[model samples]
Target chain A: MIIAIPVEQKDPDACVSSTFGRSGYFLLFDSQTNDFHFLESTFATGQSAGIRAAQLMIDNHVGVLITNRCGENAMRLLSAGNIQVYQTIAGSARDNLERCLAGTLSRL
Target chain B: MKIAVLSGKGGTGKTFVSVNLAYIQDHAAYVDCDVEVPNGHLFLPMDRASFEPVDVMIPSVQTDRCNGCRACVDFCAFHALGYAGGQVIVFDNLCHNCGGCRLLCPQKAIIEHPYNIGSIRTGNFEHVHVVSGSLNPGQMQGSAIIRRMIAQTRPFPNQILDCSPGNSCHVVQGILEADMCILVTEPTVFGANDMRICIELLKLYNKPFGIVINKSLDTRNYIKTFCREQHIKVLAEIPLQPELAVLNANGQLAAKQPEYRRIFQKMLKNAHSLVAPQNL
Candidate 1:
């Protein structure tokens, strides 16, 4: 599974989100089996950015999502598409990605 | 006179007013609470000494203490934690440090630990002391650092807070503690919309405020008329002067412009009059 993930460094497998804007991942993942992407949600999913983000996630067919955190509206949008959101995990991008693959992130 | 300068949108003269006001006052401490993009230092360069690091609480999981009950995740309002299987993966960056995770942890494995998000820097520009805090990039929590900088204040007679542009937590924390807030804006459409939001926030907090039209348009402004209709006092206005922008971009204080200095001096007088009790 070529799973997409959010990483500090923006690489082919990782989409790094910058604190400032559109940089946070609207990542593409080949595998749905493991890992999640971090998503910072706007308060309302109706926002242009948020709407496009939700659409992009669905379009890309990402299986799992790992984000630093998520708000209510964003969670609802992602959930509507059957995407599971795991809450804040703050480590270097690679370390957390490995945990997701192992399915070792459930016991918070 | 503790004054806070704010705008609901970014790039609209919040820092301009702050840096110039500090230069004109030459005695007050200038606090830059916009940790996101603290550009005030560029405007008012000084010999700054770094202040203490700003720390935020992040939840740590102790496997031995956790009993595998997913209560913490179920109770999290922010969805900051979860446990679907027998594994503990902490999203430290996602955590808002709200304590729900620790409180709801069935196994008592969750513990809060301090994490450094950013730091503070203090300096002197002429005689005016300047302090600024910036959030580390990729950290969404900007307000915490802004709050930390304000908490460092000593009850002073006069201080100037050059707030971040926006009604986000960073701006609120910077403005909420102020005796008065100064809304800075231009005469454009973006200015009008953002000013309305920011003005509403000030009203929500019941913080007394007036308006300062920075980079004012040379032709005319319906904004001044709009404010008058809404009963907002106009503290000052600075026209779109190319020289001022150039100097400002070059790391020069706008107040150094003979004209700009005169304008702030006049506004300072008006600021006092607006906030001071009438000697009736």
Candidate 2:
């Protein structure tokens, strides 16, 4: 399963971004392979940035999305794609992902 | 003569001056272009007999003809279109209706459809024809509504366009086609700053304009000094009166009073003289 986490930067140690749409980078982690890749958001500057960000998760074949907050439109699109979105507390990207894996984070 | 009353900031009395001007002048049309919150109807007695919807062309994709190459998605600058699950999806909210997607679609799958975003109402109030546009709540295409409003408006001998407050695209749309612009401002630091920005915009467009000082209290003449320094005319000044404020808040035309009637008449005369000569 591939998980997409909105992060402040491409680095795993970077803080989890507060915004799901305008985040600097989305870290896509494959739990099965234990590998990760950075997916740059095309909607870095757009009106429906959150919706486009959710579409990015769909295009990347992500099964889960980890973020601080998700807008109504983004949540609708993400849910339509059958991608589960989890809300995490303020922490580094690696820490949030670890909590998400342990099933401690709440589903958005 | 088409005169646009505008301001860079809200609560600067653009509507206050505009609605009154239309009421006092003969054969004048009051066009409220502030579609977001068209409160001009409150002050004027609308006939409610004439109204029309403002619609814009939104793109639609023919699924069978689409190859799902994501070309149209990449072409949309507003991010209104996206490609996922081997299909292209359209977000109507973000669509500017620029027709770029339809023009750039390699597979010839995109088509245009009309989407109503607002309504324009026309009525007779106090012997003056009143036309106003009201945008639907949560709609983002304000400029499109203004454009549709202008297209439907019949040119009269005198027209007063009550523009939305702010230095946005919608305000520019209202100002661009006008023969003259009246920037309504108050006597405050923020008012002066915003008025200066508006002045810069007018100068950039090379459009002729004047100033109307509204709600002038016993404060210093900062607005007068700024206009003088910029070589702009102070068309009229409506003194701050508590009774006038009370009347305005209750949607009553302050021009009903003899004093305000004289003020609006003088303003109309001044604006006509400022705009008429250039046309000659």
Candidate 3:
């Protein structure tokens, strides 16, 4: 099962890699192979799925979503599409995923 | 021409630009679609000529026809309708108005009816129509009233939709329908970051937009550099003028000032150049 992880910057401006047009993250996680590939979501999307976010999820057939804190509407939408949303996992994408797979993170 | 001033984040002066722009335009309609907290009415004094109520349709299932099969609960993708044993509960706030449960129910117990989610205040402001949409405090679906407010405009009128914060349905609803979206942003990391989210949604909707840097903190290198690399047009730059902010706080439109009238006029001109120029 491939999963999608939503990410945000602790402070984008402080980061040096031009957070201008860059996205947070819509990472692709291969559960079977344990390989992680990320797709960027458009900036300021926060947790909402914009065009790129939806497109990436649809194109990649993401079955699960991991995020820090997602909006209620977004959680419902993703859940409706059978995408399991794991929320309230604090920290970076890698840390959250580890927690999610370990079955120790709380979901909103 | 419908112009939406939006940002992915809050406090970037979306309503500020919207109120002043509408004031300067004179004949235009200004709609504060930020139903959760519509502040546009603060800057522009309205005459309260007329006001109307807006309602949204929500599903209300009749228990008599419910077979206790839990069919409605199973069909509801939003978990809005839930059944534990026999009794079914409808969480109105979670309902998205998608009408999926009603269609899927075999007993036909799910009936749709209008729910009063908000009210709209319509008034004349110096020849401009000032409209404010206020959502019911506990209601979650404020975007429906926003759309209704947009639909109530006069024929071929230049309108400015002062959108809400974030990329929720409210923001997208404003951005998707507007002719041109004038993104109100600041030069901060959070501002530009939020603007970038707005830009993605606009691009997704295939709408053209320009950036309006508001409340410039005398440092705009990051935002300008980002816009430069993205090939986006940087529109009028409104510096962090505390005088304008104070004036706005006191329910005054900056466009009322003789010195800044030209800026609003030019913004109107720029807005006219975007999609739906005929509306301008």
lDDT of model number 2: 0.85
Worst 10 residues of 3 chain B by lDDT: B78-87
| Cα distance off (Å), candidate 1, residue B218 | 4.2
How well docked is model 2, in DockQ terms?
0.50
Query: Which runs of model 2 end up more than 4 angstroms from their true locations?
Result: A9-11, A37-46, A58-61, A79-82, B276-280
* lDDT, residue A65, model 1: 64
User: TM-score for each prediction?
Assistant: 0.71, 0.91, 0.70
Return the candidate ranking by TM-score, descending.
Answer: 2, 1, 3
lDDT of each: 0.70, 0.85, 0.73
Give per-residue CA lDDT, model 1, range A12-93, as digits (tens). Answer: 3343343211335444444454343444433322323433444345446655666665444445456665666553355555
Q: Which residue pairs clash in candidate 2?
A: none
Worst ten-residue run, lDDT, model 2 chain B?
Answer: B271-280
After TM-score superposition, the amount by which residue B83's alpha carbon in candidate 3 deviates from its true location, in angstroms, is 1.0
Docking class of 1: incorrect
Q: Which ranking of candidates, highest lDDT first?
A: 2, 3, 1
